[model samples]
Target: MLYDLIILGGGAAGIFAAINAKLTHPTANVLLLEKNAVLLTKVRISGGGRCNVTHACFEPKQLIKNYPRGEKELLGPFHVFGPADTIKWFESKGVLFKTEADGRIFPQTDQSETIIQALLQEAHGLAVLIKLTEHIEILENHASYFTLRTKKEIYQTTNLLLATGSSRQGYQWAEQLGHTIQKPVPSLFTFNVPASSLKHLSGVSIHPVRLQILGTKLFQEGPILITHFGFSGPAILKLSAWGSKYLHEQNYQTRLMINWVALSKEETFVKLQEAKTHFPHKTLLQKNLFDLPKNLWKTFLEILGISYKKRLIEISLQQLKNLAQKLTGDRYQVEGKTTHKQEFVTCGGVTLKEVDFKTMQSKICPRLFFAGEILDIDGITGGFNFQNAWTTGYIAGKSSL
Candidate 1:
């Protein structure tokens, strides 16, 4: 059957596009194809199953900063359908949302199923046909329509939207359609410090910490979580997104510098010296000047070769300097990386320059569009990526119709 619009991939972007296309033109025929048995798999596992729908960042300019790859290209598209629109769109569908303190927006029910059901219901209500476990084996772009051959059958569509979300098949299809494919690389991952002495301190998190990738200008300041594998948290994930390409080039073997205190070395030293002067009788084990967790502080003292029983007065000037240095610039060798939970993001796909962000349409192929991680657009953790999917999906859907 010839469809007015055929959206490949049943993830957030594809589903959203299908719904929007039908909404824009009620008579238009839309079909969604998913290779997986289930739809919205990523949404089901996002935010530890809560489903981070979008960020509370409403301003397009401010919202663009969260994206490392599509920052510049997404500016115009976000201005059209930004996070505010996403919230309103969901709310219109009776899905209440709550924004967390960190600006991540999730369904008030706190269940990813709520989000999945909302999208599915909207699509069903609009008469959008959804086929599961259907993989398109071949795609041919004719002068007017596109031919897609699946293992089970063949279909044709006038407008095709690819929201495959970093799947290699999507890249191959886009390349086949005369579009340039950027080399895909993993993004939003955690560092794996195999030899880290702080492995026992897993689950310890520090707020307002600074993390810098040594030998590069990549850095991020936020909360850092120490996992048994390595470092996984806002700061590390943000740094990983920004440094995805560089880390991939380095083979995921790089040096990470952590500022536990988020303070300069000299500032940390001064603070330590003040602690010595004011609380000279306080023992190092009992007094943590930086407000770090007790276990983490104890581990730091051990790593610094300083006795926990040592009083502030007993700390020599050199020892104080060393402690300050350690707090401000603790270095770790990242031997590898682990995907940040199940929300695996990629840093590359269809090159941004080759796509028209204004309408999310392919510049090289007429009636062809892209959305979600299938394009070279990935944001750091905290709902920015979803915003991209929604924005691009909305534009693609509306424009295609």
Candidate 2:
């Protein structure tokens, strides 16, 4: 097949790139190749099917900070195109988005189908030829043209964009094409322990936990979940991302210290002291106004070997300190990691050094372009990753003309 531009991967970046390319060169034949039977598999399942469209933080500088992998390198690219533009682009497509308190934006319809339909609709309008079930196994560049060999056919194009993200196959293709790449690592995930406290609390969520890996500078905050196996939630997911290598080095065995209350020990200590002073006659076993789940609080106290039936006035200072330690510095053993639905990410693609961010074009292979998760430019969760898709995809799409 012959085309002006051939985009690999039918996901967010590739599809957006196709449409953007057509907008720049109306007559250019833009072909998008996807291996999956359906395009936007990640999009369909993202945010538990809601599809976090983009984050509310529209500023380029602030938006880039969310990324752990490509923050420094993305600064320049973001200045050219960022979250604000991402929101505007999607809004223009008729898929309205709204932000949550945590800055995660979801389709107002709360269905990922809406966002995918909008992309498919735009691609169709622009005459973008999409070929699903076509997996490109080889990408070779000769002079000013690029050739992509798939399982069934060989595709030739003047401009080529590789948006195949995360897959080692994608990384290999880029390395073969002479691009430096980062060694891929799992980013977002949850921890799995054999007999975790969260085993029975699958859906129990604690919002805004100040969590630290048992012995490191790494810590993160957001909502946390007690899964059937262990702990998950935005807090754990973000921590996993930020400390990917650290966790890997530790073999994921590092204990995680959580401030379940999310408040400083000093603050919580003061509150506890006030409670003890005022409620000296109160039974410790009874429920208190601390707002913690009763079962968890009771279990923690039990570990301290303190009987709940004991009167607050009768508790010794040593026991009081122990209770304080349990509340403010609870620790959990991390046995291993569990991938969060294939982590819905693209990293370790084409290296950043070889791509000109200004044009989203390859430096070594002229007339070849790159965008989205395929270029070692992955953003953190939120609309940041999606924004990368929009920006780089838009640039590659338009520049190919």
Cα lDDT tens digits for candidate 1, 1-401: 78999999999999998988988999999989999999999999998999999998888889889999889998899889998898888898899999889999999999999999889999998899999999888899999999999889999999999999988999999999998988999999989999998999899889999999998999999999999988998999999999999999999999999999999999999988998899999987777888999999988888889998999999898998998999999999999999855679899999999998888999999999998999999999999888888989898988886
- What TM-score fits each model? 0.98, 0.93
Local distance difference test, candidate 2: 0.79
**Ten-residue stretch with the least lDDT total in model 2:** 340-349
Tens digits of lDDT, candidate 2, 1-401: 56888888888888988988888888888888888898887888888889876778766678777888777777787787677787788789887877898888898999999999999999999899988888776777788688888778888998778887676776777777778887676777788877676587577887667889976899998888888888988888888878887887788888888888877767777766776888988866663646777776677777788888888888787787777777778888889989866445534557688888888887876777777787776666666777777788887787876
Clashes of each: 0, 2
Off by over 4 Å in 2: 285-289
Error at 379, model 1, angstroms: 0.3
